[model samples]
Target chain A: MSEAALLVESLAYEYPDGNLALHDVSLRIERGERVALLGPNGSGKTTLVKHLNGILAGNSGSVSVDGVRVDLQNKDSLRRIRSSVGVVFQDPDDQLFMPTVREDVAFGPFNMGARGEELDLVVKDALERVGMWELRDRPPHHLSFGQRRRVAVATVLSMSPKILVLDEPSSNLDPASRRELADILRGLDITLLMVTHDLPYALELCERSLVLAGGHVVADSRTREILRDTDLLSRHRLELPLGFRVD
Target chain B: MIRPNEDPLKHPISDHHHGHDFGERLVLHRHSIVHHLEPQVKILAMFLFIIVCVATPIHFWQAFVVYGLLVLGTILIAQLPLNVVARRSLIELPFVFFAIMMPIFGSGERVEVLGVSLSRLGIESGASILVKGTFGVLCAVCLSATTPAREILRGLERLRLPNLLVQIVSFMIRYVNVVSDEMARMKIARLSRGFEAQGVRSWRFLANVAGALFIRSYERGERVYLAMLSRGYSGKLPDTGHGSAGIRQWAQGLLLPVLALLVLAMTNIWMSR
Candidate 1:
């Protein structure tokens, strides 16, 4: 396997209210590997991912992206790390905050100190990558939910992050849109860490899966192996579709 | 949840075939000469006009006439309709009416107008106050109608307004429509469920709605901040690609402000003599 692109060592996090969200969690993702963080609701998956970009600091332990430590003191480094790991949040409404689509996509490049033709190029290239060039002038609020989600991804992609972190990439999507999203993810070679409750989606897109239960890495195995373990899935409140065959 | 017909998330229906342009239907015609002027110029011109109008004594009929003419000229030059200005200006008219009443209630000479006894100085000052306030309101309306909100914000930023205030205004303008739509949908949902509160007790229902909206907005804010950070948003907002005004553009923008100031200065000199 390629050297670990991300390393989290004994990561522990507690909410301000003294609720322990993550406890002694440790995982490492290899370069160019797509890792699905499978979990039930409130399983600390988000808290763990948030640490990747230094959005939330772990109460104990450390997160290192590409071997560089992520912390508050190295904020400039954190900014670079954040740009390197583009996060597409679950909610497109939250992601696409600008009045127009082009503006929203341009936001990232502009923040990265891209100006003049360089910024224009970044925006154009990113929009084209997601096949949203035609909808560049449209306001994001006016787009269909799927389109907005694609634009949301494009907004982060504009920054040219090495790792694309997505939260619930397929939630609330129509089947066609979900398939489209899956296809989009499959085509991209970037290291992907997707947090999802969609078991089938996780199986299809990721070769490896890590199941988190009670803030601990309970299962780490190949996608097929995890899917085949029916008893293990039910224990964590996760299940496969009835009568569904795994290829 | 995807209610295509009743989707609160649906974009406002666009009438593409009618040749209805976003700027053309509105008083704010994009790309017009007035529209392209620097924001500071527009702001300064408006300020000078308001100050001159307000400074003039209430009995100076000529001064009010000049101010009205200047406002009318501004509207014509902006190519905005009078009706639009009149309707929007009403936002502050009630407040101005209350202020103007001060003169009527002040202790001074009593007079009769159309056989109704009224304070003479009160009547005079009230008329003057009304004209001053009306001129100020007109000037402000013209600023908004001719200039797009984005440009106005840029102008505010250029004029050294508090950065926090400018950012707050920009965010408010961008999100106000979305928030309003959310409120409208909430109202519809409430109505469908047979919501009815007829008295002071209704305030609690309103408060609940407000609280719910606040929570939703706050959650939305958290998500937005995360999205920003994901895209490498530091503390500062990125520039919108509208750089500083060019020399020629700057000169062109200064033209109107200089003319307005000159006219005001001349009027002040004449009035003082």
Candidate 2:
């Protein structure tokens, strides 16, 4: 594996309406590093994640996975980047577009040319990993929000990505589901880029974190260290719930 | 940092939630032979059966009787709910009523029945349409009632239907409920704030709701596409599951349509005399 699993240098993106979503954002995540991308809403976290897979090509700067640059306009590089860097969107419904859970989970693998028994094995392993194997044949919309979220993870996991990026993963999940997902996420051995507002979740699962505000990487340090900085957290619109403190 | 009770053991996302049957009404009588048949075979059989029924000349009235028996027998074999099927087929009521009107407006030779004059050609054409249309609707309802929407889409894809058309139908089946839920929530939000939607002027609000739904759906399309692209979707849906149907399965499914075809032939021969 390359030493620098993901590298973003001075990335800047401006929407068609002239609103800048990301500005001078630089990040480097080493291989096997579990890092949290913490930021407020509209803080360029998602914009930066989109650039990782070349989904959105910024106006300037470059993003590379495993040292190979991601050219958003090039089909071959974009395909390589997307296949290696799997992103699980916040809305499971948006990603789980296939008819059944099995098909949805198998979608990525099959798209990459997996067929028949091999595809079934990939799907089975992914579903079983997420504890959704029993419900593989079920339609996604029939499940609750919590169950669908797990299936969404399986959809990407089946691709066997080298880097997993989750956007707002724990939002709207119940406490039990949240804990369950955190555990599942921690157990996976891969480079993780989690963009989340849940500080407690970030503390539990991610060791390193970068705080983004106004489209810049304002702080990069240990998760615990960032949480201890009360002024930094507050200024970026992040908070710890009552009775909780960073020791 | 403030640590949670680090014991992941306390978190229990039980498997109980999957037990609830959401689409049971759509896939009722799941154990029936008809339910087990391949979706492509079922679709082809239904198409052929309807074609045979519609092509039968009105003079072959006896063929309609046979077609009706074939449908009723299949319904019984499939163990489908008669009342539900009949109620669902009520969608054809307006068209049936239109067929009923054909006798009145149809310009044809006049006939006297019970001291009332009626068009003879109108009676013949109207009755044929009613008989053919009702049976055709019954066959369709039986197919849908037995098959899940998912399998039907897969079946269409397997049968070499244009992938785009099949995908459109698949997305429609998947999100028809989601969009409706959004609309429902919007209505509830409006109602909670004391917006009564009961007047000629209320149509303006309804129009706005429609406009918002369209815009949201358009945006949702983009997100879904991005999601698809993220998963390496390259303008085509991969088909890696669902093998071709067995010959035995096809033979079993074609029995209904084949019997109907035979009825059509018999009626043609008899009416020729």
Q: Which candidate is the best by lDDT?
A: 2
lDDT of 2 by residue, B142-254 (tens): 88789877778878988889988988988877776666567667766877898766556767877897799899898888899999999999888777455679999999999
Interface RMSD of 2: 1.0
The residue-by-residue lDDT of candidate 1 on B1-273, one tens digit each, is: 222234222223223211122322334565666676777677765775576666666655665666677678778877887887887677665657666675557667777667766777776766766777777878877887786555677777787788778767766656655666676688778878987655677778778977998998888777888878777876666656465667776665555445555666676687779
**What tens digits encode model 1's per-residue C-alpha lDDT throughout A1-247?**
5447788899899999999999999998888999999999999888887888889998899988887788867878988888888888888888887757888999988888898888889989888877788999776656888888899888988898888899999999999998887887787778899999899999989999999989999999998899889899999998887787676
Pairs with backbone N, CA or C atoms under 3 Å apart (clashes), candidate 2: none
Compared with the true structure, what per-residue lDDT tens digits does model 2 show for residues A34-124?
A: 9999999989888888888988998999888988899976888788788899999989989899888999998999888899899999999
lDDT on C-alpha atoms for all candidate structures:
0.77, 0.86
**Over the full model, what C-alpha lDDT does candidate 2 score relative to the true structure?**
0.86
- Could you say which candidate leads in TM-score? 2
Model 1 — TM-score against the truth?
Answer: 0.84
Candidate 1, position B57, lDDT: 66
In model 2 chain B, the worst 10-residue window by lDDT is B10-19
Error of 2 at B152 (Å): 1.2
